[model samples]
Target: MELPVRCFVKAVRRCFLSYICLAVFCGCLMGIALIQMIDGSFKMDIFERKQNVTKPRTTTLETPVHISPLRMKELAAKRANKTDLKQKWLNERIERLNKAAQKVQMRREVTARPVEPSDKFHIFYYAWYENVQYDGNWQHWNHEYLKNWRKLDTKVYPTGKHEPPDDIGSNFYPSLGCYSSRDPITIDIHMKQIRDAGVGVLIVSWYPPGLSDGAGRSSDLIFSDLLNAANRHKLKVAPHIEPYNGRNPVNFLTHLKYFVRSYGNHPALYKVKKNGKESTVYYIYDSYRTPASSWKELLSPKGNISIRGSAQDGVFLGLLVDVHHKHEIKRAHFDGFYTYFASNGFSYGSTWKNWKTLSVYAHKNGLLFSPSIGPGYIDTRVRPWNSGNTRHRRRGKYYDVGWRTAISAGADFFSITSFNEWHEGTQIEPAIPKSTNGYTYMDYEPEGPNFYLNLTNWWVNEVLNKTVHF
Candidate 1:
């Protein structure tokens, strides 16, 4: 049992090392077991430190629960109330709409579906400038003409009412309550279309003729054919006069005297007489340029002419009402305003409603409201926006707003901006086919027969019979 001291020490060291290694192995196994107990599974000792070494258990965050719908309804009921005036207003409007719908239904029952293009609808053509002068002939290009017009002698509609498109007539065709000069043949063609469409009148775009050397003159040739055609067609002719363009009181009275004397007896001539006298409607295009005082003076004795022939004058001034510059509308003293529409610009969408509200105020003040409808908007190109979208949707929902707004405004009449303003691509004229946003030629889907025919008829029906409110 006895050994050298060095050997005894070495043996003791070996025993100590063995005992330490056994204790370390047992400790690792226990740690792994503990980790498995917590995790509900077993893993190698290498992963035991990662699992069993957790500092603490986490507490889950509580989620808030919503109240029941029954409680919400009770709360809402306690606060809910509607004003009598608002309720009455809504009811009256609904009643009006219902009556309008019923009337439309009745009309459909009575009048056969418009099978003829001419019979379908009527639109003011000259305002859009789709009619151009070519070789002493005024050539018209419109959306309807472009999409459906055939080069044949007679343009036929589904209803088979074939009327040769005149394309030639007088130079001065009445339009949009005014008169403008074009080739005689062009005017004739335009008039024929109006007649075919069953349009009741042509609001001639008129201005006194200016001299070759910037001097004032008695009249323009534009009025010559308008009066003649209007007389012949038994269509009402209303001449819009402007006194500011050297149309002073004397000249105005002279022109009025001439117009009334020459065409007064014609069946188509408009004579709005009240209190035993012929009334004149001087639709001033630029009311601000020519003040109300000018109008007053023109109708007065000092400006020239005798008051003897002067009778009841119901002057209706037309101007584009800018809501931002509403002061212009208020200051102009217009009997009514002719508001314009651009489907794309700032005036599109919700702004249309604001214009409608303004229209209501104008109507309440005895002003006749006339608003414009165009193919689309191009004002952004003319007056570029500093920021945001410079372009707009031309064909889709954009164009619909103007059409719907015009109806909703209970518009006195709808003035389609152009039958042919092709540069902006809003022409309803044939021979010109181009599509720009909001100003596309035909923005309809099935693009051939049904769209154009139905559209024309719809516009015609709305203008002739329907009533709308915003």
Candidate 2:
């Protein structure tokens, strides 16, 4: 066996080699198995490098913005100055108004007239509401009757086709005046119409007096018109100052001059008798409110030009005293005064009895006196009436009675309440009493003469000419 073992030494080496190879193979297989067991992933790699960092930079705290004290003070001073300026403006305005008021009061005291029945008393009406002016545009005109009336002739009024209606004779409204548009054409036309119609004198309305306010501002506008009208038509213009306003004296005087200078020589300018000097007619609405100061200023010796213009020779100034304020007669400052009443008011019933007494007083004072009459009152449109105060028939029974009473009192100049005041149910035209038609706010119907016109005609024959026909 020993000999055999020594002989197989090489063989044994060979066998050992074979064994090592087998072991190597087994290790390789194990490595492959481990790789398969675990999950594998492929990734894209990227690399970026930045600059080196330096020491942190230091920063300083910021100071807040501030406003200077001087600027604040400057703003406050500006505001105060503005306030002072406004106050000064208001003070100046008030002072001017006061001075104007004082001037008017003074005039009323000196130039007032007393009533004289023996003198010629004229009846007039304010017919402004019928002013349908034509300013190139027909849309501004409101009088349709004017167009029809104008077709009659140019002798009365040559005003354009769109001119106002000459409705004063039948449908007059008290809201109109000749000076409205500052255009002399209207004045000329108005005067011509009055002259052609045989209207002796026009009793126009005036304001800025005690009974009226700034309504008198437009008075001057018509001053130039009055001059033109008077010169052309010999139509007199009598401005009736309303005693309701108690306006500024300075303003009134200013108007006074404008009226006199512009129409001084006009043939239509009012004349007191025949050879009087002045060419103006001043009619006060009431005697009571004629401010004493205004009277003194008008007739004072200071020689104010305005007073002289108004008081020059031909002037015939008069006053109208409403029954409501008749008590002021004792203190009235005027050249001539007249008595008028509102029979529509319940109080008028009692006041009617006082007409005789007032007439006697006016006659004794050497003053010119006139009276007014009308149908019962019921101004339903302007002021509504209750059941007991319904509108009266146009020619109601009371209308004739009222006329008789006025005539009996020797009322030479009688002013009918109105020509066409439909609101008062006193319109005689359209035959209020017998006609089926009630009222036409402004329309004119041939069938009726309107209550005012009826009364006017009556006065023309009975009072004005002392003759009555129908």
Candidate 3:
């Protein structure tokens, strides 16, 4: 109050400056408090743009409330897992819908259209099945469970017979129900399926006229019907020489003669004219079961009992199980090799990764390379303990992968493992969704009964359009 006018002005200026600074500090604290109240993370972004995808997926974009680091990590993991689950579910739903639409479109063409035979596609056909309607009783439907294959495993190997029609031996149920192979209607239907699928040849399982495999009946009569049906479909027939009770090099010649005299005149008997020579084709199943020395006697030109120069001589293919079979096949003078197992990694021959090496070996050795393709494999119903070889179809992805591998391996020809080998669950024939009291059977869900047939038709076209020469 007693100071000069200039000093009084300076004091007033300092007091105003200090008051303004205090007010600014108070405002900053309130701003911080307001931000915390809104979002704990405080990771504000002015440009919070949406993703530019065709169908933007729902995702969590904000951070959690303040918590322990461990708790935060756990929450993040849960969110990530949830996102992954949503993605998987969406993908499956899309696939199912697409297949449903595709199924509807394909059904219209399936029955009306018939794909012509290229003779490059072969399908393994079976004829041992029997039913009460066609045969006297349910012969093969009530199949016996084989002894435990895995001796070391102590799992219950359920023994006894498969009680059908409520129950059957296979894990899959047929769309046609339990039917006989000899039934005329069944044969016609099978022929139509094969023709519609663009298959050219049927490698029918064969045994000497009256012989068969374990718990199976003679199939020679059924084979005759198959020939007629094949004729109607304009498809060729090749005999799959199964290892019967007394199959040997000496008797094989006789069998060959019998085939020539028996069904040789039929137009459906698959034959080829290579280098001015005409002959039929024979698939030797479990060919390695016999000694390579034994096979040489029949296949080699200079052997004591050779079929090389004979008129009945034909192309011979052997089953390959292991690496040694490679040398065995060559030494035995086989015309070709086929990896028949449906499970991809079940054996050295069946492995997808081994196809290239095998193909190269076959080509270098002047042997035909025909890789076997299967929809899937599951023999748990018959061989209960041997679950290691089971292959799940995963809708249709498994089959597509098989086709891709075959084409990439430069397969000389494509052979489906089975059209109806129900015991091993490798059939591509129609199968309906069926469930019984005790268990539910496997079916091609979402896709119809003819799913594999349609899928096969697509692949056959793919192979034909390709530059691969059969």
- My TM-score estimates for the predictions, one after another, are 0.50, 0.48, 0.76
Q: Which number leads on TM-score?
A: 3
Model 2: how far residue 266 lies from native, Å: 1.9
Candidate 1: regions farther than 4 A off: 1-185, 196-198, 211-219, 231-234, 241-258, 261-264, 271-280, 299-314, 323-333, 341-351, 377-399, 421-426, 434-454, 463-470
Model 2: ten consecutive residues of lowest lDDT: 43-52
lDDT of 3 by residue, 1-470 (tens): 55688898999999999999999999999999998977854433322332233434444455333568898799999999999999999999999999967964664245323457678999999888888877888877888899985668887778999988879999999999999887899899999888889999999999877788866677776777889889988999999989998889999899889888889889999987755787888899999999999999889999899988777788898999998998999999999999989999999999988998999999999998889999999998989887888999887778878988989988988889889999899999999888888799999877878889988887887677773333
Supply candidate 2's per-residue lDDT for 143.
28
Deviating ranges (above 4 Å) for candidate 3? 1-114, 467-470
Residue 212's lDDT in candidate 3: 84
**How far off is residue 44 in model 3, in Å?**
41
For model 2, how does the per-residue alpha-carbon lDDT over 92-148 read when each residue is reduced to its tens digit? Answer: 989988885674333223221221122243444443332325333222123222222
| TM-score for candidate 1, residues paired by index | 0.50
Model 1 agreement with the true structure over 274-390: per-residue lDDT tens digits: 447655444544445555455545543343333434542444445554453334544444456665434434442225666577677767776666666654433222222211322
* Backbone clashes counted, model 1: 32
Measured over all alpha carbons after superposition, the RMSD of each candidate to the real structure, in angstroms, is 14.5, 28.2, 14.1
Against the true structure, candidate 3 reaches a TM-score of: 0.76
**Cand. 2 TM to true fold:** 0.48
Stretches of candidate 2 exceeding 4 Å from the true structure: 1-121, 130-199, 207-234, 243-250, 274-279, 290-327, 340-351, 375-377, 385-399, 419-455, 464-470
